[model samples]
Target: MTAPDETQAIRLSKRLAADLGCSRREAELYIEGGWVQVDGRLAEEPGLRVRPDQQVQLQSGARAEEAPPVTLLLHKPPGYEAGLGGIEPGAHASRSRGAPEALTLLQPDSLHAEGGPPVRVLQRHFRQLQCHTPLPTEASGLVVYTQDRRMARRLAEDIETLEQECIVQVTGRIADGGLQRLCHGLEFNGRALPPIKVSWQSEQRLRFALKGIRPGQVPAMCAAVGLSVVALKRLRIGRVALAPLAEGQWRYLRPWERF
Candidate 1:
């Protein structure tokens, strides 16, 4: 039997990413973020495994980019949780093995069940994307995933580093240069965020493109501008636009889709 064909276990990492159909960087992120599991045990190192038959999986907190190789141009309503839980416009919260899932600021339904998978399904799949956003857990619009690290990093930087675009409805009379101030005079947590492009779509309707936003910076910027945001929605991320999706819907990214 030649020593059972010399079956050997392999360490996981970039190689594992190719084997598992995720990005190398994502695999590392998953491991570092404590999302790796082997043979029903938490495996911290990507290179630690015993056999091909051993179970490999991810944890809940690490599986945000579930639902396969997807790119959603979500219409992100005002109150849906930005994470795996929430209620407003997206998917419904999937009940845990029995624990009611986790507590979320928004209703626990919008984050999991729409065109996307149930939170439990996502949590069961890949927890691999790095550089997660720390929003209110009730934020909405454009999320991406892939088995390609190169594409993922490019998308991440293009969306977060370049000017991100959004449409907001404001209230109250405008102070002079309020939009101008928000476009260029914004700062958060002491670091200077990137400048933005702001203009009026109509009275009470504003269109903005800002870079280096800190999660909920738009709302904060509105508050600073003394403008009450009656409604806020993300329309684009870099070159990816929300034009094709209806509320609560998602789709796989095209092979030709570039940042």
Candidate 2:
């Protein structure tokens, strides 16, 4: 797949501003304060080019003067694109006009109100928060957006390797041994797929746990096994799960939470 233009040789401060929704001055301040890093190394230069392969991140323990980065876990409902604009390659590129901004889902009341640590809502938290995980426009599930460059880089670089668990609701009957095929007999982009764990969540729902999944891969795998997908929902990504947060609502990723 072709890399997005934004990922190639862009100035670090510009990238930060674009990703975090802050001004260039703010981005410069963050970088100069040693709050920003490129590929795990501290970057003091705002003009540094953020190569496509290099990851950009902010220190988890930034000082009070630095705008605290925020990582949000959103229960993305169908119809909204994950990112501000379609920056990720291969995913859908356009969002319907009048579609709600997924960030709006992050309201004061939506904060995980049960038992976890309480997170403050700040105006800056809503600004420039970039989506790390891009869900298809039709799919509904947990979506992650963050201002911390480090978390963003980690999720983006590890996306293909990180295990994602999805629940797929299907129609039609599965051919005998189809379950086994789903677990082992799939390929994408003309390459044999890595071994995956697939099992029946229920009569019509199939639970898939796999790494290196690409866009539209699940439906293709289902069709290869004589099943038709009716609905699909991602339930987990790495150690994070979509629970407690209801659809169209969002909550903060606690300081202790990873991925």
Candidate 3:
């Protein structure tokens, strides 16, 4: 008995559930798995709004067979390659002599102590995950790897724009005005480098928060300011900070967490 033209749009998951005789959760799963079509186009967001008259159809033979994508946060220890290529400083003698694979660090014991919901690890989960940023093998901090293509694409596209904060331990005298030059006046690869925020954490430690950083750029930046980088460890990326994750350990990125 609803009045004509008075039916407001409802959530797509709700509409799909009512139309397809399934639970709202199932509808959401279907939508996220690319099995639901809205007006002949695939709809991925379960929270999308749908008009009463809009067409919503479940693709024939559509099933949520694929496992959900996963993201992992690892506290990379010095020695292991963040992606590929680099020697593992502390690898077991039994391990093959080559660049240590980061995946080996993702052991069950390495999971966060206050673990959230239990997640079963499948071989497929590790198959095609793409690492977002590559930390140098000599440095250690948080590293991200994900199986979500959308998330991967976003990170790849915005990498140069995202700010990364690092703590660098150094040795040597800092020249007068050296800190100012490090903050503003610098060049990399024959081009003017972007401005960075640099500060002293301690007598021998410097804090740097910068964007568009290149591989080996941190060392080069320190060298420019009359500091020799003894060690460097990333502490933050975007809004995500490296918490108390133990070195060489990893944990599943919570569903609610975002970089």
The candidate scoring highest on TM-score is: 2
Query: How do all the candidates rank in terms of TM-score, highest first?
Result: 2, 3, 1
TM-score of each: 0.50, 0.69, 0.67
RMSD of each: 12.7, 14.1, 14.2
Candidate 2: residue 104 lDDT (0-100): 74
Model 1, runs deviating above 4 Å: 1-78, 83-135, 155-159, 186-194
Residue pairs of candidate 3 with colliding backbone atoms = none
* Candidate 2 per-residue C-alpha lDDT over 1-259 given as tens digits, one digit per residue, 9 for 90 to 100: 9765763588899988887888898888778666887988888778888876778887876542654787888888877766633322124456657766777777667766662534445555676788867776667788888888999899878877778888889998999899998888778779898788999979999998888776567888888888998877778888998998778877778888776
Query: Which portions of model 2 miss their true places by more than 4 Å?
Result: 1-64, 84-98, 115-118
Error of 2 at 210 (Å): 1.0
Better of 1 and 3 by TM-score: 3
lDDT, ranked from best to worst: 2, 3, 1
Point out the worst 10-residue segment of candidate 1 by lDDT: 99-108
